[model samples]
Target chain A: MSEEHKHTNYMRIFWILLTLTIVEVGMAYTMQSHKALLIVALVTLAFIKAGMVAAYFMHLKLERKTFIAIVCFPLILAVVLVIGLFPDVGFKLGGKHHHKPAASQDSGHAVEHK
Target chain B: MSSVALAAHPPSQEKEILGVSSGKMAMWLFLGSDGMSFMGLIAAYVALRIGNWGIWPDPTKVLAIDLTAINTFILICSSVTMVKAFAASQEGNVGKLKQWLFFTMLGGAIFLGVQVYEYSQLIHHGVKLWDSAGRPAAEWLHPAIQGHSTLFTATFYACTCFHGFHVLSGVVYLAFILIGVMRGRWTVNRIEIVGLYWHFVDLVWIVIFTIIYLF
Candidate 1:
C-alpha cells in the first residue's frame, strides 16, 4: 500500500526519454562511419531510456526488491542467448564452407567447372 | 464455509506474494516471457546480419530513418500518456483517466498507421517477405545480393511486422479497457496492469528501433 502511494514524476521521465531519443538519431547520422562506436553509443542510450520508462512509468522502482529480482531472470537469459550465438554467427566458424557453393555460383565458377 | 474462511482471514490479512498483487504479478510474468520472444527475433536479426556482414545492405541506406525517428518519438509520447492515464486512475479521477487513455490509444493508432505507410512504401520499392526470384528491385541493394537470398528484407519485414501487430493488439486492448472505464467498471489495479503492458510495448520498440533501424 505504501508503494502504491509513492509519487512518480512521469513528465520528467518523459523529457529524459525524449532527449535521449533525439541524441540517438543525431548520433546515428553523424557517426555512421564509425560503425562500432555508433552501435555502442546508440544501444547504451536506448537501454537508459528503456530503464527510465520501466522504473518511473511502470513503477518498477517502487516495487519490492524481490519482485525486481524475479523480473531480471529472463533479461539475463536473453543476454546469454545472444552471447552464445556469437561464435557460430558472429565469427562464422563453419559459415565459409557452407557458403562455398553459393559463392561459386556468384562468381560464375559453377557453370565453368561443370 | 466461504463466509467462515473470509471471517478467519480478513481482506487486509490476505497474503501478497513479494508485495505485489496477483494480477500485477501475472502481468509482469507475461511481460517477461513476451520480452524473451522479442529478444529471440532480435537475436535472429543480428545473426543474419553478422553472418552476411559483407553483403547485408546498410539499413540507413534502405530504411527511412527520419520517418522512423519521428515514429519512435510518437511512441515515446504514447508511453507517457499511458503512464498519465494510470496516474489519473490512481487518483480516482475518472474523467482524467478516460482522457489520457484516449490520448494513448490515439498515439498507438497513429503509430500503426505510420508503420503501415512505411510498409507500403517499402513494398513499392520492392521489399518482400520472400522473393522467389532472388532479386529485389531495390537499386541500392548490393550487387552481390542481386541473385542471392533476400535475408535483409526478410528479417526486416519479420521483425517490424511482428512489432506492428503488437501495437495493433495493444490499441484494441486499450479500447476494451476504455469501454470498461466508460461503463464505470474500472479499477486502479486494472489500469496499472494495462499500463504495464503498454509500457512494455514501448520498451520492446526501444530495443528494436535501435537494433533494426538505427544500427
Candidate 2:
C-alpha cells in the first residue's frame, strides 16, 4: 500500500472509532433505565469497534487465510470458556435451588493468592 | 551448471507460507492466549456483578467518566499513530517512522499518567483492594450489604490495573523501539511485531472501557 493510501485509511478508521465511542457513551447515559437494551447496545458497539481495530489498524484484512486461521483458532477455546463459566456464575445449574447465605459473608475468604 | 539449475527448480509446490513471518505468528499466539486470560477475568467480573445484582453501587456514581473518556481517546489516537509508524517503516522512511513512534509512545505515557491519577482518585474515594479479610472494600459501598455481594472494588481494580500495566509496558516497548530505530538497528519487521502488541493493548482497552466504565 502507498503511504498516502495507508494514511487515509488509518485516519478514516480513527474517526469511525471516535464516533462509535461517543455514541456508546451517549447511550450509556440515555439508556440507563432500559437495562437490557443498554447492555445489548453497549456490547454490540464495543465488538464492532474491536473488529474495526483488528481488521484495519492491525492489518488483519491484508493477511492471508492461513494466517487468519492460525490467529483465530484459539478464540474457540475462549468462547467455550466463557460459555462454560456462565452457567455456574450467572445461572442456577441443574435447577436445584440451594440458598447459600454464607456465600456473601465468605467474600473475605475468597481469592487466596499463592 | 546443471546441478545449480536443478536446485533452483526443486520445489513446485508451496514450501513457505506466503507473507507470514515468525515474529507475527508468535505475537498472534501470545495475543490469543493473553486475550483468553482477559476473557476469563471479564467473565468472572460479569458473573460476580450479575450474581450480586442490586446491592452493588452504581458504577457511574462511584467513578469518573469524563477523564476516562479522554484517556480512551488518547489510546485510540495512539493506535492510529502506531499504525502510521508501521506504514512509514514499511516505506523505509526512517524519519517518519521515528516521529510517529515517538508520538505513539507519548500517547501511551499520557494514558498511563491519567490512569495513575484515576487510581489515586479512587483510592482517596475509599476504594481499597481488600479489607483484613481479603474481600473487596470501598467507601461508597451501598449500605444494603445484608446478604448481597459487594466485590466491585476488587473487580474494578483487578481489571483496570492489569490494563494499565499493559499500557505501561507498551510505552516501554515503544521507547526501546524508538532507540533502536535511531541507532538503525531496528527494521520494518521489528516495528510490525511491536505494532501488533501495541494495537492489541489498545483493543483490550476498548473492551475494558465499555465493560467497566460504560455499562
Candidate 3:
C-alpha cells in the first residue's frame, strides 16, 4: 500500500538473481584453470546477487536512508575486518612462518596439532 | 536554558526510529550482528585455506558443486517466495500470503533436506570434523596434503553446518509466522520483519556456496 512498495518488481529481481546464479555456477566449472580470475568472478557475482536480494526481497531499498546506513555500517566493518586480517593470516606472517619447516619435516607423516 | 529554547525543543514524541518500526529496526540490528558472526567464520575459513594453499584441496573436487548450485537456486527461489509473501501481506490478501509463506517454508525445508543428505554422504566417505591420528585421509583429498585433512574437514563442516542451522531456524521461524497468519494474529509489519530474516539467510548462503563450495 505504501508508495515505496508500489514499483517493486519482485519477479524481475528474481530473474536477475537466477541468471546470475547460473552464470556463477557456469564460471566455477569453466574457469578452473584461471584460479585468480575465477575467485574474482565468483566473489563478484556472489556480492551482486546478495545486493539484489537485500535491496529487493528485504525491502531495504524502500527503507529510509538512515536505516540503510545503519544496516551497511556493520557490513562495511565486516569487509574491512576480513581484508585487514588477510595480510597476517593469508601470508602466514608472525610465527606462522615456522609451520613451513615442521610441515616439510613431516612430509608424508600426519602432523597432529590441537 | 531559556523558556524559548525549551519551547523550541519540546518533549520528543515516541515515534519510530529511522522511519521504521522499532521492531524492524531491532531485527536489522540483530541481523547486522549476526552477519558479523558469519563474517568471522568466513574470515577464519579463508585464512586457513590460504595458509594451507598448496595442500588445500580443490573445493570443487571435495564438494558437490552441481548439487550445491541447485541448492543455491532453491534458496534464491525461497527468497522470492518470501518477498511475495510480504507483498501479499501488504496487499491484505491473506490467502495469497499464506500460500506464498508455505511455499517459502517448503523451499527452506528442501534445502535443509539436501544439506543433510550431503553431510551424510560426506561422513560416509570418511570426511569428519576431526581426523583421527594415523588415519589415512579421505581418498578425495589431494594426495600430498597429509595432515591437513582436519583443517579442510573442520572448516567445511563449520561453515556449511552453521548455514544449514540457519536454514533450519528460518524454516521454523517461517512456520510460526505462517501459523500466526492462519490464526489472523499477525501483522503486515511482522511479515516484513520475518521476510528480512529469510532473505538474509538466503544472502549468507549465496556467499557461502561461492567461497566454500565453488571456490
Candidate 4:
C-alpha cells in the first residue's frame, strides 16, 4: 500500500511539471507587448518547477520536512546578496550604464570596442 | 569481551558515526550547499539582466524551444527510472535494477548529446563566447540583439553549461554504482544515496529548463 502511494505521487509530480513547462512557453509568446506580465509568468513557472524538484525529485519530502526550510532559507539569502552586488559590479565593469538608453550610450562604447 | 560484543551488536542507529546514517545525510548536506551555488548563479543572472536590459539578448529567439522541451521530457523520464531502480534494489531484484539503471544512463547520455549538438548549432549560427566578435550573432551592426543577445548568450552558457556539467558528473556517478551492482556491492541504502544526488541534479535542470529554455 505504501509502495503504491509513492508511485501515484510520482505520477502526479510528472503531470504538474508538464503543466508548468507549458505555462512557461505560453508566457514567452507574450514578450513583445506585455513584458511585465511575461516576466511574472516566467518567474512563477520557475518557482513551481523549483518547488517540484525539491519536494519530489530531491526526496526532500521523503527525508524530512525540515530539510526544505533548511535548503531554501540560505538560497533566499544568496539571492539577496546577488541583487545587492549587481549594481556595483555590473555597471562599474562596463563602460556603459543600464539606466541610459542603448541608442544614446552606444556611440562611445561602440567606437572604443571596434 | 569488548571486541566480540562490539562486532556482534553493531552500533545502534543513533550511535553510528553520525546521529543519522553519515553518508546519506552528508550527501543531503552537500546538496544543500550546492543548492546555494546555483542560487548565486541565478541571482547573478537576474541582477545583470535587470541592470543591463539594453544589452541582454532575447532568450526565446536565440534558443530553439522544441528541442529543449524534448530534452526536458528526457530528464523527467530519467528521474522516473531512477526511482524504479531504488525500488528494485530494495526488493533484491537485480534484473530490474540493472534495467532501470541502463535506462537512466541512456537518458543522461542523450541529454549530454543534445546539449553538445545545441552548442554547435548556436556557434554555427554566430553565438560565440568570450567575445561575440566576427560572429554573425553579435556586432555593432544591430543594436537590439547587442544588449539582450549578448546577455542572453552569456547567461545561457553559464546556466545550461553548468547544468550540463552536473548531468555529466551524474552519469559517471551512476556508472560507478552500476558497477557495484555487478559486483554485489550495491545495496538499497547505497542506491538511495545515489538516487538522492541524481534527483538533485534533475531538480536543478527543472528550474533551468523553465527559466532558461521555456521562459
Candidate with maximal lDDT: 1
Per-residue lDDT tens digits for candidate 2, residues A1-114, read 366876788999999999999998888888889989998999899889988999998889889988888777766786787666654655542232345444533332232111
Ten residues in sequence with the least summed lDDT for candidate 1 chain B: B136-145
lDDT string for model 1 (B69-120, tens) is 8899999999988988887897889999999999999999999999999988
Q: What TM-score number comes out for model 3?
A: 0.85
Residue A16, model 4: lDDT of 85
Report, for every candidate in turn, its global Cα lDDT versus the true structure: 0.83, 0.80, 0.82, 0.74
RMSD of each candidate relative to the true structure: 6.7, 7.0, 7.6, 6.6
Residue ranges of candidate 3 with Cα displaced over 4 Å: A1-8, A93-114, B1-15, B130-149
Q: What fraction of the native alpha-carbon contacts across the interface, defined at 8 angstroms, is recovered by model 4?
A: 0.44
Task: Write model 4 residue lDDT over B1-215, tens digit each, in one string.
Answer: 98788765444322433233566777777887887788777777777776666556766777778788778878888988998898888788999999999899999999999999998887766565554455343443233355454666677789888889989999999999999998887657678888888888888887777666654
Clashing pairs in 2: none
DockQ of each: 0.55, 0.50, 0.57, 0.32
Candidate 2 segments exceeding 4 Å error: A1-3, A93-96, A99-114, B1-18, B130-148
Looking at model 2 chain B, report the run of 10 residues with the lowest lDDT sum.
Answer: B139-148
Tens-digit per-residue lDDT, B1-215, candidate 3:
78777665333322379888777888999999999999999998988887677768777776778888889889998988888888889789999999999999999999998999988777666666545564545544343334554688888888888989999999999999999999997877789889989999999999998898887
Candidate 4's C-alpha runs over 4 A off are A30-32, A86-114, B1-20, B130-149
Looking at model 3, the pairs that clash are none
| Range of the 10 consecutive residues with the lowest summed lDDT in candidate 3 chain B | B6-15
Candidate 4 structure quality by residue, lDDT tens digits, A1-114: 477777688778888887777667666765747877777777777777777766776666665546556656767776777766665554444554544544435354343334
Best by TM-score: 1
Model 1 residue pairs with clashes = none
User: Model 3, A4-80: lDDT tens per residue?
Assistant: 54436788888898899888888888889999999998899889988988987787888888889999999999999
